[model samples]
Target chain A: MVSGHSSYVMKHHDLPIEVHDLTVSYQKKPVLYGVDLEIEEGSFVGILGPNGAGKSTLIKTIMNMIKPNGGYVKIFGDRPRAGIKRIGYIPQKESVDWDFPVTVFDVVLMGRYGHHGWLSRIGKEDRNKASECLEQVNMLAYADRPIGNLSGGQQQRVFLARALAQESAVYLMDEPFAGVDAVTEKTIISILQEMKKAGKTLMVVHHDLASAKEYFDQLLLLNMRKVAFGSVSEVYTHELLQKTYGGKLAVLSEMATEVAKNPEP
Target chain B: MKNWVIIFGGLLISSSFLEAKQIGSGEDLNWLTQAERFIEMKDPSIRKVALGALLMGLSCGLIGSYVVTRRLSLFGDTLSHAVLPGIAVGFIWAGEKENFSLLIGAGIAGFAGVCCLSLLKKFTKIHEDSSLGIVLSAFYALGICLLTRIQKVGYTDQSGLDSFMFGQVTSLSSGDIISLLITLLLIGLFITINFRQLLVTGFDPQFSKSIGIPNDFLQFLLWMLIAFCVISSLQLVGVILVSAMLVIPAATASLFAKRLKNYLVLSSLLGAGAGISGTFFSFLGKGLPAGPLIVLFSAFLFLVILFLRPEKGIIVCWLKARSERSRIIIENTLKATFKILEQKDFQENEITSLEIMKKRGLSRREVEREIDKLASSGFCTKNLSANDEANLPPQTVMILTPKGWEYACKIVRNHRLWELYLTNEAQYEPDHVHEDAEKIEHVLGEKTVRQIERLLKNPKLDPHGKFIPSITDIHQGNLPRPS
Candidate 1:
């Protein structure tokens, strides 16, 4: 399986994600500005930032959900739309409507949708894949349950199962650990570590500083812009964290506001 | 299962096309004859009207599932009203009451209303509900003005224009039927091809976009489908009641369906059923309007499902609550019996009804009823003890059977164990644990009880110094006897 995936990876650029000078603004308020990143193919990277420091915005911009005002993001040297097929995304739990009438199996099956034409039937292979993913997450017993009938940790596990079903080479997750139980958090981090060992690249938006340092091999400290990007041992220092979190960059925010008011062109 | 529904729906639609003899328009005909006439498919115009209603129902139900699921029901209503101006403009542009032009005009008007709503939401601080209200009323007023102007102008083909407010089924033409059929087909194909994409986007648009699903395009397409459905339905249900067709049947289906696939199928079926039955009732009553009757029928279905559905219906929930209340009462009575036995230090095998009445704080009559209930269920046995005093009524003595004794021990054990667990593990005061344990003891399962016992290290006594019945003691139905 590893050999097969490595061959698949060799078909694309070694760098799974590349962002150059990306800037994003929502309703004329800049969220991410002049951000640049290049993630290796098999590394686990954690994005650490304070509240409102554009962690989710950077992930969204990379997914092409929000168009950047300047610069561009490429996945495997292709545009976001084309490269996204190779990406699996786990969104924030609060962003979904739990009352939606879908079973756990149905949600997991949706992961395979990108692999087939929109009109194609979900074949036996797809069903088996979905069941396998559910089994991996230990949610097989809940395959027929409505999504609303789950606890917070169980819901996060279901999302993780869906991402596993996608079988993508790259993953972008937003706060998968938020509100989850301790066992679920451990289960998720272990699975992520296994995925990294299997040659899949992962970038996760994490809020817990302690776990962030222990979980990922590399860290990206963000505060409206990239403050530091290096290995955990190099960038996890008090000085860099203070720089990422401290409000000493009042001039940068003023510049953000000014940029929002006027276009570079 | 899905194919069966589709086939059944197709047969129902096709059955309306069968040829039959025309019935006479008799002013004095009774209700049964009118019903016979409706079943005959006799009049060509009646067949056309029936087909139109079915098609309208099918399309509205199909699109309304998405509308209701996405929380866009009000948007559907706003779009329905927003199409009036387009109808008026189409009438003026066509220089007559042309079905095709009217439908096109209404579609455009619905699209424009959606655009205006989105713009108001995107550019300003106005909330979605307020923006929907603005677009709904503003377009409706404009259309009303245009419609009144057309009437004042007095065109030759303007006779049936006012019927758009409240539908006139007699005005349905073959053109209208064909357009409704086209709309139904389009909606069916769109849903079939994009079911997963639509589901994901509706459930989570942000995630859908990340997976390369064109969230914006799908949203726009859904809006277009809604507009098409509303526009085609206007001739049969009119603008005022069209939104009801979109929402009512879907709401009824949502009450019982656990999956989106079932919800859509059931909704469309209910919509079709409502359409046929409403048209039938309107047929029975010579001058009754079909549109309002259809909406009323669907509303009736919603009420019926809301109260009678098998799992979560109001009546089911009420019955469940009633049973739960009785069970709690029975368990409480058993606990009271055990308390009395414990007070006697296991020396006595029987207790008097007067003692129970005292322990439970109940009247003599209520105690008699409780003992009777317990005896009937084989939980305990009651008998009149030999009365030495002839003047006083004989006192009733109750003895717990083995099952009853074991049950009472288990309840006591659960209560005592929970109280101990709460006071020790949950950090509750010893005084505060009894009230909570009172409620939880009846509902705690065996597995949870064992887990709590293990967590608390299998303590033998509660915080109040009461012996918690051991599992072995409960199994043996054992109580200490006097040496």
Candidate 2:
């Protein structure tokens, strides 16, 4: 298999994420249609779109949590399943069961599961790493607290600490600023900036368009398909944003629905 | 899978050929004698029954923790019911009640039921609960029909077969006990080896998948283990009540346990405790079914924990609420005293009980009780002699101690500051601010009060033109006259 993939690996080895003509649908409803993207190794990108514009779908598809209907995703020149270890995924806060019987520290320690085999015990180094990550995110004081006892912003911080514990090269965060207090939002953005300065790649799904230009270096404005992808100054225009958030193009969406009705042969 | 089937087939053929012991009926012995016999363990049959119950309890409790945490309690019930038809088919296939054959047949039926449930969810629009209902009732009805047909066929060896509905502990065989032990071992090993994986998957399947946890395989393995638990426990607790064994102990443990590991350990211990106690109770009576007794004991434990556990129990919550109410009443009385002192422009340090009663809208007797409560708690000193010397109608005059004066100043400050802030910052009407401040004053912490103080720029008076006490005045235990 290594011999077979040597050529393809040599070509796309520099890209942190490569998506070629990705299409995704949920229960016969097309969410993303024939979207393509290539993310740089150390740049911070923000994904901005309206609700139901498939921003989350694109991230989930790249993570291999949701399989695309067509095309493929490669992370560091390998399939998502094999290469996902290099990526830290911070899922939406609402996707978890807050009442689950786990403490903040326990959730963060789970980030190290991929580092060792399932049967092996967690080593002292792993524990130290987890503590350091929690300290970095300013959540060490809440390490023993049950996840349910935390406020909304504190809960988001715990998830951020967990992702930081993974120590991955690339990160994909889904709405880290949603429902967070202004102070917590500032704290999380500063941490993301620090991570980027350390040469880690990041892609965040952002809801607020007002802060998008300041927080991210590159912006991917998307609707059903990719509307624009470039530096913030290039893509953060009124016309492009209007195209992305105004609404889906009537003809394109109608055709996408038709194709969904009769899927590929 | 093929190899497993072949090995199981071989075991069934060999086991069926062995001369199996027929289950014996319990005699109507005295209660004392039965209890002593159970403890002595001299009879091999009694020993087998005891071991079977223990093993069944251990396995059910371990698997049921996952079932309850994953919200699969109803699925456990459906799977238990769905295995009944397989037991009947196994009996017919072996031409008798062979334990190995029955287990294998039940396993097959459970696997099929799971497959059907998944297929229905994947390909159709039917909800999971409806699919579970369809599978549960349909298979249970089929099993009932088959069992009745076997009875009508007049098989002489089918006398003890009806005990599968409501378990008879005396009918447990040595082979049944062995099967239960194996199931217990399998469940224990599975949970121990995959504790972290199972936890992550159960808590967040999406994140687990992203990190290469193989969530689907782990879920399938969990279902298989749950099926094993249900099948092996059928001879001890029967089908209808097995799901209770899977849910009640775990639910009881969840009341106090904050971690999954503790929850699992406590649940299994409770399961074993309920099992043994239920067996003892059944032994003390004549012809009592052990299944319902076991289920009843677990349910009773659940109710006990529900009402009596320390952290979140009903009684604890009620006690907490009661204490909070009394504290609020004390604070309000102090605030009322501060208001009376402020009305007099801090000229007097004592207030009569009649003045407090009229200010608080309470009767004279209630006012005396409040003064006595305040004095006992070291907040004030009560002087009835002064009132008597003044020729008053036996009114109690209370003098506020320094502690009392400080507390009263704090409460009044909180109330007035909140009222002022609400009127000025929140734009609330002056009348509306009082009612809200009335409640907020009792619960405001020191930190929040400081924040409010800073936000309002240390205002001197409230919206109602009342003096909002300063911190230095509160510390000094002396109020300056309102300007």
Candidate 3:
């Protein structure tokens, strides 16, 4: 397999994520409207948008979990199914049943599914890879404990661990720190930063505006019909955020003040 | 013998030989005598029928545990009833019920029904439960229609095949016993060898699938087990009552066991016991149908266990609550005494009993009883002193022992720490953090309390500006309320 760093851009004779006029919909309602974007190799890109702005939908479309209504999305210059092993996905924790009776070790082992494929045996090597991944997230101590028993921060670590075990060059994470504590958030961000330094591409759907600049080197600001994409210093302007948030944030602050007065018991 | 058991036993005993001319007529007594002598005579026919019912019930208990726990009882019910048409077709094809073609036809029809359910799920937008309902009921109705049509043809002796609706154990030949025993053995082997895979698939399908376990193959295995359970159970409980055999024992076993292995073993025992009791009850009830009797016996045992089991049992919880309420009265007395001391009106040494009773909402008689209990428990002392005001007795100072002081301080400290943590660490509004923290305080431990305290940077005051007593001060027991 070609290393992701050598192929930062398709135009440069190397492809990371290639898409052409991708249109995705769920039950006839369009989610991605004639979207076009390319992610270069080893780029630490953050997808920034308000809730329901298709940031998650975009990730799903790229992963091929959601089929495009029209056009195409390719990962690593090929159809997603042909190269699923080269991509790592860290879905929101709520996507899975938290109460499911599986250990952190077992959850991490699932990352090897794409590599092992269907009906193939998981060997001793896979177990060692899973253990190594858990150690990276500092969750090796809790590896044997049930995933359900972990705190929100610990659970997030295990998820990151699972993604690490995938050994994919391109990592996609959706709202990794939405409900996590500061310690866990910092740990996850540091891991992503380390991955970026190692010449691996990372795309995170980030919600916090304050930490967005520190966490991401590049930002993709999106609304339904409008979009802004560039470096954090170039794209993360007040006017752009206001446009992406659809101007509701001004009213949202007023509402926050009003709600804070009655202090929602 | 119980009347229910005798009736069922006689029905089972007489039905096999009842085809004989003399046996059906004046030799009814002779058949009974023969059954009694058969045991002593070591008759293979009697042994065959007895062993057939036993193994059939055992298999129903074994595979049925999964079927019932996974909640496929009604699906099993539908497949069993649907197999009637298959049985009819088999009989027609082979020109007799005894041919191997019948079992093959039944298996094919059952597998077909399973296929229909699967196909409906895959192709249609309809929900699985709805699709299952449609297929199960439709096949059963079709089978009933076919059975009615088949009745018009000759071979009216085939009418007794309706006994499959309510199992007729006496009719099972030695061949049936061997066939059932073999099916039972296969099911047992399948469960033992694939126990871990089945457990993962049953508990968490997505995780199992994600980890590269063959989910579809395991599902096929589960469906096959259900099919075998339904088919074998129908021979004893009949198509309609087969669900009872599949569900009752497993459901009862779940009440007692948490682990999968324990659940499987207990369910087997429950199933076997229900089966034996059901068979016995049917024997005792003359002319009573065995299918209904067996289902009723299992249902009775389920009801008995539901009401009488130790944990989560109705009567036991009620009893525990009543005793706990009595204990609360004594604890409340200690609390009241401590409260009075906080005012500084009651000195450190002792105070009059009347002063303590005055603060309580309870009646005079209730306060006296509570005080006696507290003094006996060493929580406080009562002042039997002469007081001038009416008949009011002076209550002695309620001084807590070192252990009591520490326990009280822990509860108070936890409540304060939680209030601080919720406001600071969790970012809850100052006004909203106190009530929830009140309940959480009782359950938190020292490690967790310390963790929260450290996270909040050892806040001296809570969100409401109330003093949070320091742990060092709490150990000293003279932690003053903030002025």
Best by DockQ: 1
TM-score winner, 1 or 2: 1
Q: Report how large a share of the reference interface contacts model 1 reproduces.
A: 0.76
Question: On residues B294-377, what C-alpha lDDT tens digit does candidate 3 reach at each position?
Answer: 677777888888888896777788888787676656545554554565567334645445656687777767777776766676
Docking tier of model 3: it is incorrect
Off by over 4 Å in 2: A1-11, A21-36, A48-57, A65-72, A177-183, A207-210, A221-228, A236-265, B1-48, B334-355, B380-433, B447-483
TM-score of each model's chain B: 0.86, 0.85, 0.68
- In CAPRI terms, where does candidate 2 land? medium
DockQ, per-model, please? 0.61, 0.59, 0.11
lDDT of 2: 0.83
lDDT by residue (B373-428, candidate 2, tens digit) is: 88988999988744555565676888988788788889999999999988898999
Q: Residue-wise lDDT of candidate 1 within A175-210, one digit each (tens)? A: 999999899999999899989999999999998776
Best lDDT among the predictions, by candidate number: 1
Better of 2 and 3 by lDDT: 2
Q: What 10-residue stretch in candidate 3 chain A is worst by lDDT?
A: A1-10
On TM-score, the stronger of 2 and 3 is 2
Q: Largest TM-score belongs to which candidate?
A: 1
TM-score of each: 0.86, 0.83, 0.64
What is the overall TM-score of model 3 with all chains considered together? 0.64
Residue B377 in candidate 1 has what lDDT? Answer: 84
- Greater-TM-score candidate between 1 and 3: 1
